[model samples]
Target chain A: MSHSLQHNRRLFLGALGAGLFTTRGAFAEQLLASPALTEGPFYPDQLPLDRDNDLIIINDSLTPAVGEITHLTGKILDASGKPLKDALVEIWQCDANAVYLHTADSGPKKDQQDKNFQGYGAFTTGSTGEYRFRTIKPVPYPGRPSPHIHVKVSQKGRELVTTQLFIRDHAGNLQDGVFLGLRDILDRELVVSDFEPMKNSKMGELACEWDVVIGRTPDEREFERS
Target chain B: MRRVLALSAAVAVCLPLLNSALRAQPPGAPPQGGRGAAAPNAESFLQRLMQYDANGDGSLTLDEVKDRRLHALLNRADANEDGVVTKAELTALHQKESAAIGRQPAGFPPPGAQQPPGAGRGGPPGAQPGPGAGPGPQRRGGRAGQILPEFVQDELELSPEQREQVAELQKEVDAQLEKILTPEQRALLNQPRPGGPGGRQRPPGAGPGRPNGEIREN
Candidate 1:
């Protein structure tokens, strides 16, 4: 498909998705809470110059990072399905070569690291609880089989949940111990995102939508305990 | 035609680079056995299989497939669908992986030579810091050295001295964050931490912590 056509389709879908969240607020209580997963080690020892949501390009670089460009977007919600505004959402993952932004790892493997790739990025959710990141599809690392992106959510400057998101039906996921350890099928499903090809793009860009549902708000948890 | 030639040329270059690196391993030096030590490009995958084939029969059977993941892929590795996997089949599998992953694997540095220090899950155990280790505490129990600080630093693009100053302001940051919490929330935050749940994770080759204990980036 033509690149412009696909781009338009994506924008329309993005708007539609946001609209659904707005209309579904009354039914939000029925949504499943996103399962929590370990934050994992390579969260980036050093941050890149561009902390924006677009990770494909670093601060005005013409050469884009190598990898299948993935449009990652999601919403942050509470157990009641209320969108959490002003929440900080951060994500970090390895570049196409499976190297992270951390100095210890990237320092030695600097030759292999993609200098153009912004290894880490963050975005704040607005009233819609929506966040988006243009990054590469996560690849399997040496020890870990499942390709994943580490995600952290914070509100009011306090961490809510630290988790990781996985690719749905990645062949390696079956053998991944961390993925298999999740005994609850629902929780397992929550962490995986569908990486579908954009409608008409020659570049094979992928679009992923993953909503994060925290088990409880900090205030709610504290109030319940009292 | 040009792409094929280029690809073949790249493969030709990689074979020798990997072989010489394999040969350089001192006779019987303990293999860098940890999962993080070996980079899994096409060449290394084949090299690793040979290392497992202790008898040098040039063929590997199920018994030789010690790594569970390789064992799982073993069935598919048999291109002819034969029970036994021959070097020919392994080569085909390698070719397939190279094509699918879109990586040439020719440019990677030699295995043992380019490995980052403190390679395994965090630097040698214990909180004691290693040379060049960052001022942060060593990674332990899956909670040490974090990405959040780095995220904050990068988002603000703070200078090195400013970063140090920010680190010094940890007490203030904590106080500000604490103000947002209710009394009950404060108590919960102060409670003794529980041992982290198991399910090891890392960024490609990055283990839990570095020797310098800088920030842990898992």
Candidate 2:
């Protein structure tokens, strides 16, 4: 009887220790909040007719955009590492010809713009805090040497953060003024993501994942609002 | 008996809590906040090679390499045409190519030196640029200098004032570049071009001279 009792006590202690360890791990593993970047001159002044997650096709049209297709996926998390559901995520980027959807960018280069490219997309994270988008790989434009996608996150009718995602090791990143402006290596690392070739994907599609962590502090919330 | 029952209940409760807490952080959870950590080195040549070892068998077969361009490159390294490339074979090919590069005089390729197929198609992710193909002097440590090349600036159609501003930025970039280079390398960069500015141009239709289709405007 005593032996059985000792075994039960040991099991209880082991379970308790594991529970404590996991709780400590979760609290210790604080995610870096994504740094805010300029919205730039191109946020699609006029939203596209089809603002769906897929930027490759428009309104049942068959022809896809003229560039490498990319599947971008990620999660939205709060400061405490908990997934934030119902957060609206938006992305906008230049087309293959380096023309943005905004008039200031596409107006002059009308001939160069890719008509099929939607160029802007939005998604609302579900219970899992996960979102996905189908878009073309970004290309470098005139002033900006680095190729990038501009991202924004909003919740409860308030903007949380606006940032840019860059191709992790693109050569142009080192030269681009905006990318270099992020002097903190940690900030830069948080914004950069790898665009890897999708396994068994025909049509040369690429895939990338980048999680965004937003600050929950009242001070940061007020600052973001301003 | 009551103590044993209580201990059993505690284990049951704690077990589920531990499992749930572990599940909270899934595998490949995003990076954590801390001192800036270096981005994972996924682009190194070795890592690129290992990607073809689909079965983690430490060897690559032509059929295993799905990318046509990469398949061709590896096929060349398979000197025996046995349809498989081992680490030894790859190392041998690399040494041979390095030797060939060493023999060529700095800043010049021998006439009719065979160019690798698809060398212009941004060849793979980590393909090194051919000699004299990179814009300006070769930069070490993969840090790009010269924010905007003259061709890119011209393409922008910047106004005169904008051009002036860019020129100022270029000067600042140059100053910063000088700080990073060793005195010897700086001196090498200062050396006069062999055939002046005209010597730098790649033979017509040879290649874009820049990768990633950046200069494919026309």
Candidate 3:
């Protein structure tokens, strides 16, 4: 009887701890708005017919894009830490050979571009504000020092914010003019994310998670005014 | 027994709240009131395009864009198979392009000034003193003390006042660079050119990989 009573006490304590944790989490500080970054010369001029979330596979093509495949996932949250549903998140980057899906880029360097690579893709955030993209690791262009993925968040025809994610600890980052242009150290850190190896994946794939915190969407701003 | 029941009820009440709390990513400490420069936009692009569309026809043809780079842009801007590019087409392409990238395309210099072909060129970010001392990626082979070759400047259509300003700026930059360059680098800077090196050139230093160590291969 005493042992059963002890077991009940332990369960009660565990529940109490969880309840406290949940309460603390609810009161957690507001999230930061993601830093804005310049979109460089290479966004796809003619968006490919297959503009889906999985950039690696275009429609039903068997051949995936050539590079380290990254499962990039993130949440789109507002300044108040509310998940933004129905937000459109778009990402674009160069192919394995650093070729963009643009005429100015591909026109001269057609031979180098990986024809199989979709090069750009988009995803819509669900109720949870979660989004994901399957893309190759971004590589540095010939002149641009840093390897980065361009990201844009939009809603209902209005662009909320545009930024590029940098590979954290990339040596070229220090030399990248655009990266340096970001004066705030904290804001710079916000844009740089660690692309770590996804554990237990036999295929040696990579994973990265970055939460985009936007200041105020046009809708939110309008609602507040109303 | 009564206290245990009360505790159980409290836990049940908190369970739904737990889901949202659990889903919340631990908040990052965002510094209050942080500000960054807004990304480059379309107005600047039209301004540069208008300057190049010398005839002010509200449309551009290849002949007007003297720079080979700008000519490449003209081809990309010609979205319709019709060959001639209207201002509306350029604006649409620019909007899409800028929206995709977050900023204006690189290489178009600002009004009243000209930058080397690759605007982002130079030593890595945070390099000391002279950030503008190296040949851009396009001019990887450019030498030191090389003046903008006359033809390239003509292609850029620099005003007489702008040309004089550029000349003065070039001389000052060369003198400033001379103080820091090694003798070997100095020799390379002063080396005579075999052909007319392109214009608006900066005196070249050993490029990005040197002084500040490059980020090791990831």
Best by TM-score: 2
Candidate 2, B133-203: lDDT as tens digits? 23333221122364654334332334334556766776788888889999999887766434332233334
* Count of backbone clashes, every candidate in sequence: 11, 0, 7
What is candidate 3's lDDT per residue for B89-114, written digit by digit as tens? 66665544333222211222222122
lDDT of 1 by residue, A25-122 (tens): 22222344454555555677777778999998988889988777999998887645678999999999877775789886677667767777798999
DockQ of each: 0.01, 0.03, 0.02
Give the C-alpha lDDT of model 2: 0.58
User: In terms of lDDT, which candidate is stronger, 1 or 2?
Assistant: 2
lDDT of 1 at B65: 50
Estimated TM-score for each candidate: 0.45, 0.49, 0.48
State each model's TM-score restricted to chain B. 0.29, 0.32, 0.30
How much is A123 displaced in model 1, in angstroms?
0.5
Off by over 4 Å in 2: A1-27, A218-226, B1-218
- Judge the docking of candidate 1 as incorrect, acceptable, medium or high: incorrect
Lowest-scoring 10 consecutive residues by lDDT in candidate 3 chain A?
A217-226
Error of 3 at B35 (Å): 12
